[model samples]
Target chain A: MILTEMMMKVTPIKNGTVIDHISAGQALNVLKILGIYHTTDATISVLMNVTSRNLGKKDIVKVEMRELEVGEVNKIALIAPGATINIIRDYEVAEKYAVDMPDLIVGVMRCPNHNCISNTDEPIKSQFLVKNKNPVVLRCLYCEQTITENIADYLI
Target chain B: MFEKRHVLSMREFSREEIDAVLAMADTLEPYAYGGNCNSLTGKILALLFFEPSTRTRMSFETAMMRMGGKTLNLGPAEGSAIAKGESLADTIRVIGCYADALVIRHPKEGSAQLASEFSPVPVLNAGDGAGHHPTQTLLDLYTIRKESHLDELSITLLGDLKYGRTVHSLAYALALYGAEITLVSPPSLRMPDQIKADLEAKGTTVRETGDLNEVIEEIDVLYVTRIQRERFPDPREYQKVARSYKITTDLLKKVKDDLIIMHPLPRVDEIDPEVDGTKHAVYFRQSFYGVPVRMALLKMLIGGDDID
Candidate 1:
C-alpha cells in the first residue's frame, strides 16, 4: 500500500485555535458562531471543502491569538459535531480534543420561538436542552419548542 | 412536593404529585365557598396579568382572599410599568421583593417560566399565550374528580384542540391517569400531532374523529373549549370552525345519563343556553372548582399548614 503525504492548505498558527474537520461548507457558520466577521481583530484563515481520509471533504478554521471559549465550542458542536479544536502554541499542538456537546446549553443560541422570553429585551440568556447530537436537535428549556434543522441559524 | 416550587407546565408533574394536589384540593373545598381559612394570611400574592383575564385573575384573587391572604394586582398592561417598557425580569424582580408568590398571565408563551427565573418567590403560571395553563388543568381535574371519576375515564375533548391551551394541558394530564381520550375537532382544528403522539407513547388509548355524535354516549366527560377568534390567523377561518361544534340539548339527549359537560368558560356561543339547564352541564360548577384548586396550590406552595 502506498500512502501519499497530504499538504496543509492553511499554515499552522503559533498561538491560537485550529478548528478542524468541520462539516463541509460549515466553515462560514463556524466563523459566525465565533462572531468573526471582517471587523474581527483576530487574524483568521478558513479552508473550505478540503479533502481528507476521514471526512472525505471538510473545512478548517485557524484563528491567531485567540483560544475558543467553552460557549463558542459548544455552539460549534451543533453545526460541526465531528470538528476538533487544536490549541496551537509555538507552532505546536498544545491541546487537542473533539468538541463535546453539552447536555444543557446556556447563552449560546437564540430560541427560534418569536414569543419566547429569551427573544424579548429581558435580561435572560437563551437556553436549550441537547436532545440529539448527530442531526443536532435542541429543545428550548422555556417554551419546549424544538429546533431540528438549520441549527446554526439560531446561534447567538 | 410542591413547596416553594414553580408550577409552570403539566409536563413537569408526575401522577403522584397531581394526585397530591387533588387530595389537597379536597381538604380545602369548604373554604372555597364561604369560610375563614387563614392559612396564607401573611403571604402576599402578586397578580401580574399582561393579558386580559376574567376567571383566572379573579380566581387567584378569590383564592387568596378566601385563604385570608391579600393580593396585589398589576391591573392592565396599559396602566402598569410594563407599558413604560420595563422588561418582565425587572417587573418580576420588583414584585418578587413585595410578594410571597407571583401569578402571571402574559400574551407571550413561556413568560411565566421566564418570570420564574427572575422571581425570588415561586412563580405560578396563570396562563401564557397558548402555552401550558397547569392550574386550569388542575382545576379541571378537580372538577372531574368531583363530578365523575378520573379512574378509567373516557373523555371526549371537543372543539378547537390545536390552539386551546386548556385542552392541551388537560389531555396531557388525563393521559397521565390513563384516560381514554376521543378527540373531536375539524381537520384544521384537530389536536396537535406531537401531543397525540406523546399521549399514544404513554400508552393512553386515543381516538381521533370529526364527529362527536359517535363517541358522545360512551364517554365519561365531554370537555369543550371555545375556538378563540384571536388564535386564528384569518377571521373567516375562525368563523368556519367556531360554529362547527355547538353543544345543544338535542345532542345531550344521546349522552350517557351520568355524563358531565365542562368548559373553561367566558364561552361565547359554543354552548346553547338551552343545554345549560340539562343535568350534563357541569361547567358552572367546574368554574367554581378553580377556587378550591387554587387555594390548595397556594397553601402547598407558600408553606401554609393544612387547614383541617
Candidate 2:
C-alpha cells in the first residue's frame, strides 16, 4: 500500500484549528501559548521542522475539536508572527487567515518586570504594547519595561 | 489642556503640550512664592508617598496649599493601611473618594501608574522606583528654561543614568526641545542603551563620555545626580564611582561662562559646598521651581478654566 505524503504526515482533523507556517522550532511554545500540555483531552498533532515552499522550514500544530480564540490567536502572533490559522470543519478548510499581531495585548502574558504594577495585587491585568512584530518585543504598559527575550516563558 | 489628565510619564506629552505646561507655570509663578491664589479652593489632593521624599512631597503640598487646595498625605508606609496588608488598589480606591486628584510616590516602579488605574480623579506621579518622575522632569525643564535657553542648548547629564529616574525622563524631554545631550557616567551606570537609542532614533544628537572635563567647557547645562549607594551591589564600586564624579570649584573653572549646574537636591557629596555660592549653582533655585511647576500641574488638573 502506497502511503501519500499527507498520510505520512498529520492526518486531517474533522474539526478544529491548524496553525500552519509557525516559525520552525516553535510548536511547543505554540502549544504552551494555547495551554495545551500533556493534560489536554483534545487530540493534538505537532509537525515540527516540516518543509514548506513559503518558509524553508516551519512548524504546524493541529488540534482536534478546538478552534482558536482571539486571545489564543494574538498570543500565537507574538511568538510566531508569520503563522497562518486555518479553521477545519468536517475535514474541509472552512476559513483561513494569517495571524495579525495586535497593537496592544492585554491579559495574555505576565510582564517580566517584577516591579510592574501588573505584578502587584492590584485588580489589573498585564498589558503590553507590541513595539516590534518579527522577533517580537513587548513593552509593558505599566512599568514601561520592554520584554524582548524568551517571550514564551512570560505566557500567563 | 491638562484637565483630568494623568501625568504618568514624560513620553505621554508632546513638545507642544510641554510648552503649554511651562507657559502655564510662568503665569502661576507669582502664586508659588508668597502670592495667594484660590483657584483650587475647595479641591482636595491626596499624596500617597510610599517612599520618603523631601522636594517632591513638600513641593506638592506647597503647590496644593498655594492654590488654596487641601492635601491628604499617606505619610509613611509603616503608619498606613498598606502595612496592614491592604493592597495599593484598595488604598487608591478609598482615597480617590476623598480627593479631586491623587499624587503617588512608591518604592515599587509603576506604583503610580497602578494607582492611576484605580483612582477616580486625576493621578500625578511624584516618583516611582526607577521608573518615571514626570513632575520632576517638568520642574527640571522649568529650571532649564529659566536659567538657560532650551533652543540648541548643549547639556551634560552626569552620574547614575541607568538607575536615576530623573535623568531617564529628563533626557527624553531635553531631546524633545532639540537640545544636544552628553551623558557622563561610569561604565557600569551608563544610560540604558534603549533610552540612548530612542533619543538617537528621534534625530537628537547624543554623545557619551566617561570624563566630565571632555564636554564641560562646551555645554550650557550640567545636570548632576548622586551616585546612589543603594543602586550598587558592591560598596567599594559605589565608593569608587562616587569619588570620581564630584563637582568641584576646580571643575567649575573649566565650564562655559554661563554654564548652570543643576541637581535634584537632597544631594550627597556630588557637589562641593564651595561651588554652591558660585553663579553657576542653580540647584536651590531648581528646587524652588518645583513649587510653581507642580502648582501649574495641580491647577491644570483640578482648577478647570479659571487658570486661563
Candidate 3:
C-alpha cells in the first residue's frame, strides 16, 4: 500500500508551468535556484528519478501559479538547456518555453581561468563573444581567453 | 579577424586560434632567428614583472623590438608602487592608458586576472600563480611540432608534476592530439587526480609511477621540472626530495641516445648544468622561441586592427 501510494502519487495544479527533460539529479538544483521549490504563496510539486522514454531517467516539477521572468529564463537557459518549460492553464497544456543561447553572453558562464579577473573574490561578469558558432568558441571580452563550448562546463 | 584579447588560459583557445598562432609563428621564424626586425612598427608593449622571469618577458620584449615595436620594462614591481598602497587594479588601469598591450606577472594566484579586469588595453598573463602560462604551453607545443612535424609522439614528463602548470596544460593539449604521456613524478607530488581522470577520459594512455628509471629507456622527450620550494609547508620536506629527482649525466647512461631534454627553467639542482651542453637540452632554445611564438600571438590579436 505504501509502495502503491509512493508509486501512484500525482498532483494536478489549477494553472501554472511544468519543466521537462532535465537530466536526473539536477532538477532540485534548478528548482531551488528558480525559487519555485517552496514558498508560502505558491504550491509546488516535484518528481525525481522518474522513468523517461527519451533519457531513461528524468525529473519533473510543476509550479501551481507562477511563471518565469526574463532573468530566471536566462539562468535556466545557461544552467539547463536540455530542460523544457510548459504552460499549464486550467489543468490543460497551454504553451512551452526554451532557453535562448545569446550571441554574446555576459555573466552567464564563469571564466575557467582561476587567476582570471572573472574568478576574483570581487565580482566581474564572464563576458564572451561568440566568435565561431560551428564548433562554438567564446572569446573573453576582457582577458582574451578563448572559451570553447567543450569547456563551457568549467565556466558555468 | 582577431583584435585585442588576452590568451590567459589554454582553456580559452580553440583549435582554430591555435592553428592561426602556429601558422604565424612559422611565418615569423626566419626573422626571429636571423635578420632585420620591423613587423610591429609604432606599437608599444608594456611588460610588468612582479616576479622573476628570464624567458617569457625577455622573449616578448625581444619579439617586440625585433618587430620594430617598442616596450617599457618595469622589472620586479615590488619596490615600485606595490610597496606603497596602490592595488594591481590601479597600476594596470594606469598602465593600460600608456600602452597598447600589457604583459603582466604577479606572484599572487589571481593577480593577472584581476589586472586584466580594468586594463583598457588587452592584458596578457605572463605567468600567474601557477595558474596558466598558455603562450609557453603553445610554444612548447610549437617546438614539439617543429621537431616532430606531426603532433603525436612518445613523451615523458619526468619530475615535479604537481606545481608545474606547464606540464598540466601541455598534458591536456597532448591528450587532444593523441600523444602518449608517461607521468614520472614522486608519489608525494604526483599529477593531480582530476587531471589523471581527464586524460583517461580523453582516451590518452598515461602511466603513473615514482620510478623514472624503469620507464627511462623508451621515451623521446624528457620534460623535467624542479620541485617548487614554495609549494612545501616545510623546508626540510623539500630538501629531502629535491636532490633525488635531479637529472644528471650518470643517470643518462640508462637512457636512449637521442632523447630530447627540456626544462622550463630557473632551475636549482633538478637538472645538472652539464646536461646543458648536450644535444638533448632543447629548453634554452625552447625559451628563445617564447618571443617569436608570443610575437606571433600579439601580432595575430592586434594586427587585425589594420584589417577592420
Interface RMSD of each: 0.9, 1.1, 4.6
With candidate 3 superimposed using the best TM-score fit, by how many Å does residue A96's alpha carbon deviate from the native? 7.6
What TM-score would every model get versus the actual structure?
0.93, 0.92, 0.69
- Model 2: CA > 4 A from native: A1-10, A36-43, A48-57, B1-4, B230-240, B304-308
DockQ of each: 0.77, 0.70, 0.16
lDDT of 1 by residue, B69-98 (tens): 999999768888878898888999999999
Q: Give model 3's DockQ, 2 decimals.
A: 0.16
Clashing pairs in 1: none
Ranking by TM-score: 1, 2, 3
The local distance difference test score of model 1 is 0.88
Candidate 2 chain A: worst 10 consecutive residues by lDDT?
A: A69-78
Question: Can you write out model 2's per-residue Cα lDDT over B163-230, one digit (the tens) per residue?
Answer: 88889889999888878999999998999898999999888899999999889899999999988898
RMSD in Å for model 2: 2.4
Give Cα distance to truth, residue B85, candidate 1, Å.
2.3
Q: What share of the reference contacts survives in each candidate?
A: 0.80, 0.70, 0.23
